[model samples]
Target chain A: MIYFDNAATSWPKPPGVTEAMVHFLEKVGANPGRSGHRPSVEAGRIVYDAREAVAELFHAPDPLRIVFGANATEALNLALRGLLRPGDHVVTSSMEHNSVMRPLRALEEQGVSLTVVPCSPQGFLSPPDLEGALRPETKLIVLNHASNVVGSLLPVREAGQIARRHGCLLLVDAAQTAGDYPIDVQTEYIDLLAFTGHKALGGPMGTGGLVIGERVPVDELEPLKRGGTGSRSEHEEQPDFLPDKCEAGTPNAVGLAGLAAGARWVLETGVEHIRAHEVRLTQQLIDGLREIPGVTVYGGLDATRQTAVVSFNVAGLEPSEVGLRLDEEYDIMCRVGLHCAPAAHRTIGTFPTGTVRFGLSYFNTPEEVETALEAVRAIARANK
Target chain B: MSYGVVLVPSTSHAIRAERVCHLAGLKVKLIPTPRQLSSNCGTALRFDWEERETVEQVLRANKVDYDEVHQLEW
Candidate 1:
């Protein structure tokens, strides 16, 4: 079977990822930082190494600021809900996944105002729209590094510059771009960033985290959860530390181990290499899919303004029906429908039914893409 | 065996969901949301089969966000 939904979650993780997970379960099985025993200490090291590895990958100056959660969506919630309060304003974009939008919408109902900058029909958010959206009450500018639907890359550096000028913190949801691109918190002036491990990082499904910049103190944001953080057990008030404040209860140690391994591979291999591979694959798909009649491809029509995600709609086929057909007929796996970013779908003019999204990963090969292309051609024919 | 699954969009939401679930006398194991179901999010909560009604009560009361619930048979 050919799996093309790497943007939602990448399967067939790197060799090191599964190995580390297996190694952790077999060699070390203890709650980290909760116990000072040798095994516990080792487990703690495993978690710390993953933290450090993630910090390095993102070029974050401090490792402790990295907080782990179940996925990027969770990390984004901790950053958004925790940092802002009543009367505060948030600036976001139309290209955000529901992970960013749902929480912001919840906050909006509770008195926090929100400004959603418009993205192009291709799902590209212009820097000027973001700049114009900012207000003195705008305490945060939250958006995605790449469109989860179309994988269009946002001008975060320009947006970051604007946020810094306005004294508003910038929080980027790197759910689709992390490990696939270079994110420097120190250089970008981004106060917060969230990434899921199962995507570009090639970690286990449960792995994801938030990278808190040194610019934002942990106490400024309210603790999202309070429980045994393996620190300050006696205090019922919750531990007051960066990771401890945000990360509650036992972490997905196995997932972390895999993330650590995946992160290490990313660092050694370099993100540029991954990007190069994806660009080639994306161009290939575009070239191939463009040949098919009655197919409308979405996002960065230029091909250079996007991540590896390519979304399109075939004439006369429901996105769901098309996805199921791909799975059944071609043994191909792809994600379809709104892709959780209803706003994005609407912005790209594919709302209601949405489009078929093919999330490309570095691990996916040209031959696999060719196979998917053939399947799409056949499906389009059948639909026509 | 019957199980209750708690649905959350992000891991952070799951963390809070688990707190609410535990308080509801429901034990939740974080399982990949059964893909047969449709969601904008990726995770789900599975609980004791017998305590489905109780878990649902807790989830609804605390507003522990969930997309859908299912009874998985073993």
Candidate 2:
């Protein structure tokens, strides 16, 4: 009954998340920004509130600059596809999720040159190595705040400084760290940050966005899709201002209502406190798994250096088999396989074979970690 | 009791304008954009015309982007 797949999506969301969505559906079910009616304005308020909450959480310059999208993947696409053009050079780390890699790979085919700075086998990206990958035409640098596979933190702030010195913008995919980590766009010099609400943000799916910093040229960044933005209806072309510039069509107001509540919960329960709790559980899980004779642990193995996710493999058993036994026999739910980050798997030396990942959250306690560790131990022993 | 309307880029801007105005102790409401103001189709913040200068100043102080401010007859 224990859920360890929080890196994919959090479960048992904080108190008001479900209630807010229910309230929106029951009382204020209306399309946001599409109409001028009272209910429409009210729904718009909910969506705007979600933007403000997400903005405040990241310490972004303005809420209006926070462009809403379906999830972090879409936001990453908006940043990568909107900003980069043919002949433009971009640099990224090898420890990136498919969200960043796939878009960049597609861009590479469209004449944009890409440089993937290799990370260590432990999935750590060195800032110097990243800076070395930059070219004269390097216009942007995209990096994940943390690796989704091993949960190893990247040197985003250092990379940001390097990017700024090179006259390049830094785009951070914070799918793994947002809400769970403290990120100040201004202080960190992050030009663009993509985040997800379903993961650590504790909200419903289909709610996430990108925070566009002041350095980005709004005029040049193109919209992913263009339609009625509920504003500038007279114009056949898209509106130049954000977020309407990036956001087109009716938004997911109900999902946003839940996002606002979930973000508020994270704010009330300070990120530092949440980070500390997750660190404790992560360290415990790592230590216990390493103690098992036939279990092979991955990543930095240091709680202070990474997130709550721990990836491992049992000897003589495939990751899929281990995952199935954990689910049906042990009643523990987790994710296995490449985790949609083949590049990261290659960096961590787990490509193709993959690994069993236990992504913990603030809601997970030491007791749950202990039980999961015992389950892993039993499985490993049986395989041995 | 005439009212002044502040036109903004989008509904998100209008919502921000209303929030900042309310925090500044000025009463404001989001109303349908009057056709005469601009061709942009979105909501506008309606406030007491007497507080026109104050509303403008508050919006500027709060960095809320507004297109134009006009006195409404309706």
Candidate 3:
């Protein structure tokens, strides 16, 4: 069976990921920062190493600013709900996942003004359009680095500069591009970056975080939840320091151990190499699918402008039917439906029924892509 | 023997100090925060008083957020 739905969650993670988690469970099984014992110290070290690894991946200045959470959704919530107050204005794009859209919607209802700039039919946002939407009251501009549905990359660097010019903070949702592409928070002038370890980072689920930049005044943003951070236990008020200021409870130490190893692997192997491999596979898949009759592919054919995700529709069949056929007959795994980004589907004109998504990964080979394309061709022929 | 205790304001900083010192090959032991020290963190790093300069240098280089370093009789 071929697995191609990496956008949802990556499969068959790097060998070191599971090994590291197991090592945590066996050798360093203690709550980090909760005790002063040797095991606890070792556990704290593992967590810190993961923080440093995440910092290195994003080129963040300080490791202490990396705050751990359950996933990108949680991280986004922390950033959106934490930073934006009533009467503050925000600018975002139409091609955002529910992770960003839901929180913004909730914030909008709470009297916070929101302006959603529409993306092109191909799911690319215009940086100038984003800048035009910003108001004097606009305190933040949040956007995803890449669309989860169409795989089109946004102009984050330009948007970051615009945000800086307007005195608004730029918060990037790097859910799909964190490990697959190179991102330097400093170079891009990003103020906050939210990422998930389970996807491109190749770690176990239940691990993700937000990396805060130096420009953001963290003290002003309220934490999503507050409790014992194993520091300032004597004081009922939460600690004002970073990491602890955002991280309120016992963290997912086991998952983080795996994340550290996964991040280390990405750094050692280099993101450029991974991006090249995925681009090659994506180009092959897109080219093959476009050649097949009755197979209408979405998104641009440019491999350099997108991640490995490709969406398509076959003639005379619903997306669900095609997905079922691919799974039962071809033994190929992919995602179908709106993909949690209804706004993206609307932008691409696949609103209700959605489309079949084949998200490639670094581990996927050209041979696998070829086989999947053949399966798609056979399905298209049958539908015709 | 005289020992040195490095007190930090938080557990995260203490953990960071330990890691920085350990990587630098400084002989440091993470012990409970002594009653004499007024710190919020539960743990503190204990090292030889003679190695104060070395520990300070390593922590400073690593940017480990520490509070105070005191010389105590053991």
Candidate 4:
């Protein structure tokens, strides 16, 4: 069976990921920062190392600024809900996932202003359009580094410059790009970066974080949830610090241990190498699918400008039906529907009924891409 | 002998203080921030009072952000 739904969640993580998690559960099963015991200290070390790894991956200056969360959704919630207040304005692209859009919508209802800059049909956002949307009241500019639906990359550096010029902070959702692409928070001028470990990071579920850049005043952002962070136990108020300010309660230390290993693997193997492999597979899949009759591929054919995600549709057949056939007959796994980004589907003119998405990963090979393409071709032909 | 406490503005800085001190051969232990110190953070680093000068130098050299260092009995 071939797995191509990496945008949702990566499968078959690196061996070190499982090994690290097992090691944590078996030998260092203790609540990190909750106690001063050996196991507790070990757990704390694991969590800290994971923070360091994530910080290194994103080029954050301080590891303590990286706050652990359940996933990118939680991190996004923390960033959006924590930073935005009533009457504040925010600018975001139309290609955002629900993780960014939902929180912004909720905030909009609470008197915050929102401006969604439209992306091109191919899923690219213009920096000028985003800058034009920025208002004097704009406090933040949130965008996904890459569209989960079409795999098109956003010009974050250009957007960041615009945001900085407007005195607005940039919050990037790196859910689809982290670990698969290079992101330096310093160079990109990002204020907040939300990433999930279970996706491109190759970790288990339940591990993700938000990296806070030095420019963003940590005290300005409110804590999404407040409770015991094992620090400031004597004080009822949440600790107003980098991570503890955002991280409340006992963390998922075991999952973080695995995440650290996965991030380390990405660093060791080098993101450029992993990206090259995925781009090769994506290009092959796109070129092959374009030749199949009755098949229409979305997004540009340039693999260099996108992640490994490929979306397409077959004439006279629903995407769900094609997905079911691919799974049942060809033993191929993929994602179908709006992919939690109806706005993106609408941008690409595939709303209501979305496209069939094949999200490849570094582990996938050329043979698997060929087989999946052949399956898609057969399905498209049969539908006609 | 009284121990020297290095209070930092954040937990990340406290952790960095520990790392830099260790590399500089100054023995330091991370503990809960004493109530006497600022309530800005939860974690603080404790080291020997004799190593206060070296600790300060090392942290400064390593660019660790710290609040203050107090020579206090623990």
The per-candidate count of clashes, in order, stands at: 7, 0, 0, 0
Q: Which ten-residue region of model 3 chain A has the weakest summed lDDT? A: A375-384
Task: Give the alpha carbon lDDT tens digit for every residue of A15-41 in model 1.
Answer: 788889989999998876655355765
Per-residue lDDT tens digits of candidate 4, residues A133-228? 988999999999999998999999998899889998999999999999999999999999999999989999999999988778788888888887
Q: By how many angstroms RMSD does model 3 differ from the true structure?
A: 1.5
User: Model-by-model lDDT, in order?
Assistant: 0.82, 0.92, 0.92, 0.88
Q: How well docked is model 1, in DockQ terms?
A: 0.01
The clash number for model 1 is 7
Q: Over 4 Å off in model 1, which ranges?
A: B1-74
For residues B1-74, write the lDDT of model 2, one tens digit per residue: 69999888889999999988899999999998886777375699999999999999999998888888888776
> What is the interface root-mean-square deviation of candidate 3?
1.2
lDDT of 3 by residue, B1-74 (tens): 99999998766787778777888999998888888878778789999999999999999898778888988998
**lDDT minimum window of 10 residues, candidate 1 chain A:** A33-42
Residue A22 miss distance in model 3 (angstroms):
1.3
B23-51: candidate 1 lDDT, tens digit per residue: 65666765545767554334456788888
Would you list the clashing residue pairs of candidate 3? Answer: none
| Candidate 3 residue-wise lDDT, A1-384, digit = tens | 999989999997976999999999998999999888789878988999999899999999778889999999999999999999999999999999999999999999999999999999988998889999999999999999999998999999999999889998999999999899999999999999999999999888999999999888888989999898988788999989888999998999999999999999999989999999999999998899999999889987788999999999998889999889989998999999999999999999999989999988999999999999899888888766
Worst 10 residues of 3 chain B by lDDT: B9-18
Candidate 3 residue spans exceeding 4 A from truth: B21-27, B51-62
State residue A70's C-alpha deviation in candidate 2, in Å.
0.4
